[model samples]
Target: MTHSRKILVTGADGFIGSHLTEALVRQGHDVKAFVLYNSFNTWGWLDQCAADIRGHFEVFSGDIRDPYGVRKAMEDCDRVLHLAALIAIPYSYHSPDTYVDTNIKGTLNVLQAARDLGVSKLVHTSTSEVYGTARYVPIDEKHPLQGQSPYSASKIGADQMALSFYRSFETPVSIIRPFNTYGPRQSARAIIPTVITQIASGKESIQLGSLHPTRDFNYIEDTVRGFIAMLESSNSIGEEINIGSNYEINIGDTVSMIAELMNRSVNIVSSDDRKRPEKSEVERLWADHSKAKNLLGWEPLYSGTEGLRKGLEKTIEWFTKPENLSRYKADLYNI
Candidate 1:
């Protein structure tokens, strides 16, 4: 019953998007990858994937903020997976203007182009950070959105714009909100990569921020599966679905587990630079993924510990290579 349709994946060079591109190719779908434009023409994590997998993707380099480029990328495509955005919360603090331009306006450009192209489906990526600190446990779609930081604020604007297109113009869009996706090829700005890299580098002390904040971490593959599931399920249109593992763990506990698995005894020191602003910090996040399960027949396949082990192993392996480790700025705080 699979349609022989061309799928356009924006941000296909990113962590989740790269994984999604591989998944789609494995499922026998034609993939058009819209990578971010750069002078060096880099494809980010997409470069790390196997050459055969890379061969399967038709890559087009362009900026998401450009409407003409976005429209050209969507040409002859049946579905669009919009994953491009400025996601670094810490960087957003210093440059909120960039977030608004990229997260909000970029999404608007994609939506308008998709509507014009009459794409069969559009899946817009969102983050659980939009919900900010949990007012209640097991946050559902009904939870109030608090823009605890500039990054979340921009995402809120983007999500609202996507949903509005769905409601007002029947744009056939689904907002896929994923909670803390962690795995291979993730930027060092993420906690998992940061911890794994520091440990792999033979550091006796690992620097981190507030470790009490809890998050529901979905493995990258499962998060990408949720995106594909939304595309395949007609019921997902006009609906915002949460894709998460539903299990929450404190950052302190997560680091401890990694330490044990890595067989390294390291002291964790809280660095002021690593901590989010007191008012901006999100204390807890646990997703209510029932909507995704019932609607898209999807749920996280990897448990927290299991996913962590896999992520750490892969990250450690990658960072062990000098070439890969050189890509990360382990000496400085990313945001």
Candidate 2:
């Protein structure tokens, strides 16, 4: 919204990407959406995007892993918001090579293009998972990064790749590391959707992994706003920032809140298979988003315990709807 520029959003078809694309279009930017190409020619979550912004943005179907395609997608765009990557940690365990190919190599492709193109701004997406388990409370931008999982490891490589571009070639780049983001259109691989989908499917008891791990959950709206804030702020260039609520809640408590919002009492059955390996499990994550506030003048409206519940309420309402609920297979455990 700072000044309408030709903006290309990579991963614009995914959960947060779709919402961000719609938001940019709402702000009247000349936006191009780079979605993964599939045989069905689907645009993922963007297919169900809000009605008003439909057709306002252009779509470029291609794979992020393809450097040639990615370079072509970045052409004619002044700013690039790179959010495409492999994010599922469980699936990372099943297939680490894909994480390397998609997360690491895919990110390299973006950095190379951004550096070569001299894009006005490039905001790269990072994850709280790269911090692994917190050795201290309120993990900040300065906190040590420990890649405990294959997914996190690849992201660490990607984050460093972006930063190296900034230091080495002086590419206009900033990394926005967001904590657990949950909302409508989220896949069942995520905890909030996994629980909600199961409950919506009339399951009295739910299977879950470690419940002791705490996360600083940020609602999808706040996350999208954080992305936009970084996009508009020149001070964010060449820096890594954390976007989170700064409030921590355990998984068990989160489940209880979700159940309360849904007006149901449910039992949580422990599932070892669903859990991360003993050493790889990220025991806790609480974000210190002070850098975000200082740099971008941004903070979460849906913050703290009360805000989490409100966000959950909004999420439950969407997931309970027949049309949206039908999209997920809640009975089968999504890796």
Candidate 3:
């Protein structure tokens, strides 16, 4: 991947995508941002990016599900970072069809376009949710995939599709699987943001779901760096790599830590509406990132505790701002 190569980043208007787009621009790459088209003509998080960064991006608003639109965005681009998907777990339960269409079919569109365009490499985004409850600790790339929820199931289909493309058409593809990522610009549907918004909104009791499930979290920056490392590493092609801190902290402990950092002693109230179906919940996830280290030469720069602390502080600062905080409906339960 040369610094001068043209790159197309699908889902560039998203949280991690926006951060990655900014990072790519900062590194002097020519970026074409493939933002989801909407009736309001909104650019999502990319609208909040700094002007200088935005200036460097060639913004293309279209649906990833559209093959023509996807191909148009990939034209003349040397690489494609496909990140567009329907990611909400609860929503996936109610709208599984939408998840299949976006996560699975949308990925197919990107793969076909990348193959047709002869892109040098295609970095396919994946989530650790596909590993389910983790049959063993420190889940690695070879762990059996369990579709605990519709969202993860769709991602499984998409991941297999990318790999199939690589095998059948010799498409250069690298699957980048990131565990729980939280930070500024994250939606309130996520636990970290939900907790932060409730606390920042001056709620005395934090409403949440099950607290015993542990997760391996990676800060937004560290996750973005993992993507770049995978992109630059020639050995990463046709490989699946895990990007995480290799540390696990239960939700209960994470909330306590957040409360401590915010200097607030909020009561925790488990809500039935917030809980996942017993069979659908993932109980544990701890990433084994040895593959990432040995192959891509990538390691998380932030330890679990330090990363959570700094990420929470930055997230708190962002949510405390009236303009930013107002975007969230702290009083309502986000799906």
Query: Considering every candidate listed, which one attains the maximal TM-score?
Result: 2
Score residue 81 of candidate 3 by CA lDDT. 90
C-alpha TM-scores of all predictions: 0.96, 0.98, 0.97
Q: Cα deviation of 21 in candidate 3 (Å)? A: 0.6
Q: Each prediction's Cα lDDT score?
A: 0.89, 0.93, 0.92
Better of 1 and 3 by lDDT: 3
* Candidate 1, 1-335: lDDT as tens digits: 23337999998899888989999998889999999999987888888887778687799999998999998888878899999998999999899998998999999999998888788899999999999999998999999999999999999999999999999889999999999998777888999888878887788998899999998988788898899899999999999899988889999998988888788988999999989989999999999999999999997888667865676566567666888777888766776
RMSD of 3: 1.7
Candidate 2 overall Cα lDDT vs. reference? 0.93
Q: Tell me model 1's lDDT, rounded to 2 decimals.
A: 0.89
Selected candidate, larger TM-score, 2 vs 3: 2
lDDT head-to-head 1 vs 2, winner: 2
| Over 4 Å off, model 1 | 1-4, 304-307, 321-323
Greater lDDT among 2 and 3 belongs to 2
Q: Which ten residues in a row are the worst by lDDT in model 2?
A: 1-10
Question: Which residue pairs show backbone clashes in model 1?
Answer: none
| Clashes per candidate, residues 3 or more apart or on different chains | 0, 0, 0
Candidate 3, TM-score vs. the true structure? Answer: 0.97
lDDT of 3: 0.92
